[model samples]
Target chain A: MNFDEIYSSKLALVEDALKKLMERHKECPPTLFKAMNYSLFAGGKRIRPVLLLSAHELVGGNVEESMALACGLEMIHTYSLIHDDLPAMDDDDLRRGMPTNHKVFGEGMAILAGDALLNLAYEVFLENAMKYPYKLERHVRAAFVIARAAGLHGMIGGQVADLEQEGKDVQPDMLYYIHTHKTGALIEAAVRAGAILEPIEGDVEDAVAKYGQKLGLAFQIVDDILDVTGDAASMGKNPSRDEARKKPLFQLCMAWGNRGVWHGT
Target chain B: MNFDEIYSSKLALVEDALKKLMERHKECPPTLFKAMNYSLFAGGKRIRPVLLLSAHELVGGNVEESMALACGLEMIHTYSLIHDDLPAMDDDDLRRGMPTNHKVFGEGMAILAGDALLNLAYEVFLENAMKYPYKLERHVRAAFVIARAAGLHGMIGGQVADLEQEGKDVQPDMLYYIHTHKTGALIEAAVRAGAILEPIEGDVEDAVAKYGQKLGLAFQIVDDILDVTGDAASMGKNPSRDEARKKPLFQLCMAWGNRGVWHGT
Candidate 1:
């Protein structure tokens, strides 16, 4: 498969599904909904959601069964991005060539938008899971894995470490820990959740998880690299943000050798 | 039962459960866990969790079955408190007689701790839900209700409105909307979820929900009243902060009628 074509196709599918899922309701506050839709629709590659879809498809699991999960994963990812860009955090102004959620909507509304998205993600998935009478176990298991991946031991913990380590990190283990738990955990969960939608063997799940881990690290390293090399117009956001923050990833890889050898390092 | 006595008893139970729940794993960053525990153990009245327990008991639901949910409700409540106290949000420095999460742990760690608590709340309830093979639907339904109560149309919407309406004139309806949504929705959900642990009639559920609405409204009105009238020593956090922000609540009622007639006003 042409990876770019597949990425585009899955991105379209997720974007369409997310639009439907996030359709404005009459009772919803107009501005709150607007803020949520603003960052949500401001596109990314939809890597997590597409991984969910592709995992389900690869395992010959019912692709339909994974749609809501796919959408839910993307919502979770987007919510994190919104919060991560807040003034208290990265203090970012631009995302995907658009104003960051907090920048456009004010800090308070952006926070609410992120909170709304997080809560709504569970609503979407749980509402979908309620329909599966026979395979409710699968649904529960998928939800469990995803929730764990998103919780204290996973994304949030890594985030805490990453923030604490900012401007002061010095260890290889800490870097690996932050990169893996912060980024890799949820990515692994995306693939694992999709594969477990049906039945699968232990070995297959392990292999998929390993693949996800490497891919997630690669994804983060590439992000760090792109932030240095890519221009604002093509990249949809400013470059050199990583260097300015003195973030650990690209700096460590450069310490090791060329960027191309980041993976082996 | 002496309501105060019962409140103490349930509060103890929830605090115990929450203490156990927040017992930090070695793997989790110590600072993040410390921040979470600081706010969590700072000790509120535990009204939401108590309400949950009472509702479950009142409905002849198994009291033991509702424990995780009660803890989860309180976790959600405490997480909201932590976020609301942030500099970008309410900017409060003290909570429950102690320095607020950010003041004690810095803004970034506090934010992540709040996020972790929120995610962990779902994990707690979902993990508990997976145990009841016979009544899995009840768990799903309860999760759905709780998620919606905390989402955009519920707490988050109210928060956005409350923040936007700050330092501005507003209508009575808007005040009611903000109070009911910001403070009332989760309170209402805590009860409704506990009540629905077993089957009940439409009228019964409606009655519980209506009771919750009134209680939640009254709860906020009382809080607003306390912020103005009560001493900081008794209330833990300093009073009159709401007045400083020009928040809409007790002022509206007092403007309309005497303080004693707050409920009808």
Candidate 2:
């Protein structure tokens, strides 16, 4: 498939999965669920789950087997974004061309929405494990991988570093460490989990992992690049907003021998 | 062993396990590690881990084998507390008689510390699965159970309900739902995990589950009782804080025919 075709297909699957997941929460607090759906349904690339599914496909695994995990990964990513936008965190009033969750739902409900998403992510996985016609070991491995990547030493660790480095002239190495762990870890775990579930062996697993590492870093770099160069309307969020707030960026543009050069953004 | 002796021994073991787990974060950001240590060491009853250990003992399982899971449960609980104390959530300024994490470390760092503890909790479990002397299946099952309990249909779900109900006069049924899912789920998971690892069978598992359900509700009722009756100084916090804030109380008090009576102070 062409890039758009592949991207569109993955997006459709993710959207359907998320819609179904949110439907289950219909009877939950209506306002809170609305806030959750607002952020969850907000447009994004769905890169993490797409990459996971792609990795699974590369390993000859059926996408259906990894569907629950893919959706869970996206839920986590969405939940973090919701919390990160809270006034206590980034204080952003807008995301994806819409009001941030806390802005629309009030802070308390927003917090609940983020929390609900996190919990629901795992619930989706467990339900799948209990119901899917797959080997229990695969589900167990997937669960472990997702938990590790999402938890302390993975995305959360990166987040800690990122938050800590705010308003400071964070070193390139520190920025790299933060991004690689914060975003890169989960992306890596996503791919790894997919491969592990499919029982991919040896070099293929290593190759997919390498691909994930590169893609994750590349994705973040592209985001940095976009923040500097992309249109706010097109991106559905402000570019250069980080700079406006004096937040650290992973890239630096410098002149090198009369040539413009970009360092870590 | 007598109850006190058993409790003390179990507490001691859990303390040691927590120390070991904390050591793993030594290379983490010093501020983050300090924040994490402040709360992890601030100390509560360590009741959840203690329960898990006791259950393991009752099942004839080696406490050593289940120590990691015990620590994991405590980490999860501690992380929730740290997050709950945030300005956006419960907005507390004190915990366990000391300044709350955010008060000491600032909002950003406190948030990160909570996140790190959560991630580290899973990391500890993963390490156990990899290195523990048990069958892989057993470790996987244990990890899966813990993850599910901590996720949506478990602790976080209850938290969402509790958060949403903060200002409203929630029904008694709704109150039960919140506590049972929020606090009781993990408590149940802790005991269930121990039993799972110990390979406890049939009615024994069912019995332990029933005991856990009652114990968890009783524990919450006693907490509510203390919140009303205990000295704010001795309780290390306000005793009537829940009523002052209009938060839900356990229904056990109503069962005693004391519908509107506040207990502790």
Candidate maximizing TM-score: 1
lDDT of 2 by residue, B1-265 (tens): 8989989989998898889778865875678888989999997789889888888888898899889989988988988888888777778887899998989998867766776676577667766766654455676567677777776557776877777777677677677777778888889888888887866677898778767876777787877767766875787755534453344443445743343223311
Local accuracy of candidate 1 as per-residue lDDT tens digits, A1-265: 6988888888888888888878743267889999888888897778898998899888898767899998888878888889888767777787899888888888878877887887788877778888996887788778888988998899988888878876663466676778788898999999999988878898898888778877887787887667766787887776645443445554666643443434633
> Residue by residue across A199-222, what tens digits does model 2's lDDT show?
666788787777777667777777
Interface RMSD of each: 1.4, 3.4
Model 1: TM-score, first chain: 0.89
TM-score of 1: 0.91
Q: Which 10-residue span in candidate 1 chain A carries the lowest summed lDDT?
A: A256-265
Which residues of candidate 1, in runs, are more than 4 Å off?
A24-26, A240-265, B24-26, B240-265
DockQ of the two-chain complex in candidate 1: 0.65
Q: What is the lDDT, from 0 to 100, of the residue A210 in candidate 1?
A: 73
Q: What CAPRI grade goes to candidate 2?
A: acceptable
How high is the lDDT of residue B211 in model 1?
81
